[model samples]
Target: MNSVNSSQNNLLFTSRCPEVRDAQWVCQKVKNTFPHISTTKISAKMADIEEANWDLYRKFIDKPEYALLYNKNPKDRKFLRLFAWRRRIVKRIHDARESWRIGGKDDYHRVNNVLGQFKYDKLGNCGEDAFMAATILRINGVDNTCTAGLKVDGSFLDHMVCVFNKDGSTFNGKPNKNTIIIDPWVGMADFASNMFQKYKNVFSELLIGIKPQSEITFRNVDEVGISGMERFLLIMKHPELCYPNSAREFMRKK
Candidate 1:
């Protein structure tokens, strides 16, 4: 892993950072376009965020210590099945994100701080949140896909999330008939409808099933002043920053 990191860093920095550029553009646009957004609107956004955080905390983090005992016995098929079926782990991941944000972490989220050990002071953004959920799902022997994609008409593929099947089992290593998507980044809002509102016509099962490093190009990307190659190179660097729980555990074992 260290060797791989060395090689990736050695890749030339000839391209602009799409994430950084797009983020700055967004910030500037918001500042310029809505110099004085209504306090009511801001309060509503905060309310939604708070509601999601509250649900996650009550559902997962606020539970009694004995609740963990269910996970202690591997042979308890009923409990394990129940555990795997419900969205508790996903909620925990969401709780971590809320805690991280509330603690005032920076935008460039560091994944290790949240997943390996819960650090309220060091939080992660959407991608790290999704990766954390994916790690937990994988640990529980659940089938899921962690994805990265643009907001469909947008220039940057800046979000990441975990997509899963309604039934835990996969058909021939592919997602089964009914697929459910979970975005810890978006918190606990009705994810399906929220996703449709954000991604609209472009998000489909095809995006969920997309293989790693799949090529996708957005029209009018140059309008953002970043080329497609720059976006590609930027995304290539992101996965290296993610410190999934499995990787952290392996490091501790070493």
Candidate 2:
């Protein structure tokens, strides 16, 4: 039945149909992007959620989530930390195993924003991995940023990680310095570290000590694969690089 024009439930009318449709849309998007059932199932679960659950669903949004990450509430900050991570890699993996293994494969995709559940999450999928990581890091007072980076292969715009202006330098919240591109989402660390050491002058030319800006582009962080885990290992293997300050010196000038 058509919803009434004067209805107070505008959210219920036009938006409701699309929730189911979006689930269908997410299914199509995921299926088209990833062939394996393991990867594509995320879209399937996203499709299955009840429209009323949208409120909870939006909490998982990186766009709003990032803006709110700095809210003064200690509870909000702490929620980001505990759910993000209170332990190290080996321990995180151990704790995550039971949860990941829960419900067999189905629970994996159903697991959102809850930390350490998905393998691709390690590569920084947020709801899958990166989001959880950033949430935890922020809570720990590490100062982090979550944004998206396109692979430049195919049209898929993937998620990536970055440290905020302050976290990357001793400068503290001053964005004028070069913000490092740490692609935790893909494990890219995507900076040209070697090139910087070689050019050296690119240092002055690159960052110019100008306040840097970063963003997520609003795409939901959902990529899943073993590659994500590989990237996670690579990052853990290099805490100095992951630390943000060391990385800030190398954002590509051009």
User: Residue 15 of candidate 2: its Cα lDDT?
Assistant: 41
* Tens-place lDDT digits, model 1, residues 1-254: 69567435423211132222222222232223213212222333444544655543243345533444444545443433443333444455566656655543421232334433233323244455554544433333343333333444334555555554434444222233343344554442122333443343234322332233333322211111223453344335444322334532311222
* lDDT (C-alpha, whole model) for all candidates: 0.37, 0.33
Clashes of each: 0, 12
lDDT of 2 by residue, 41-150 (tens): 13333344524345433553444456246656675555444323322343554555555656545322333323334434342132233333333233323333433332
RMSD of each: 20.0, 21.8
Candidate 2 Cα outliers beyond 4 Å, as residue runs: 1-113, 119-127, 149-156, 167-177, 188-254
Model 1 C-alpha lDDT versus the unseen true structure? 0.37
Error of 2 at 227 (Å): 31
Score every model by TM-score. Answer: 0.30, 0.25
Worst 10 residues of 1 by lDDT: 217-226
> Model 1 reaches what TM-score against the true structure?
0.30
Predicted structure with the largest TM-score when compared to the true one: 1
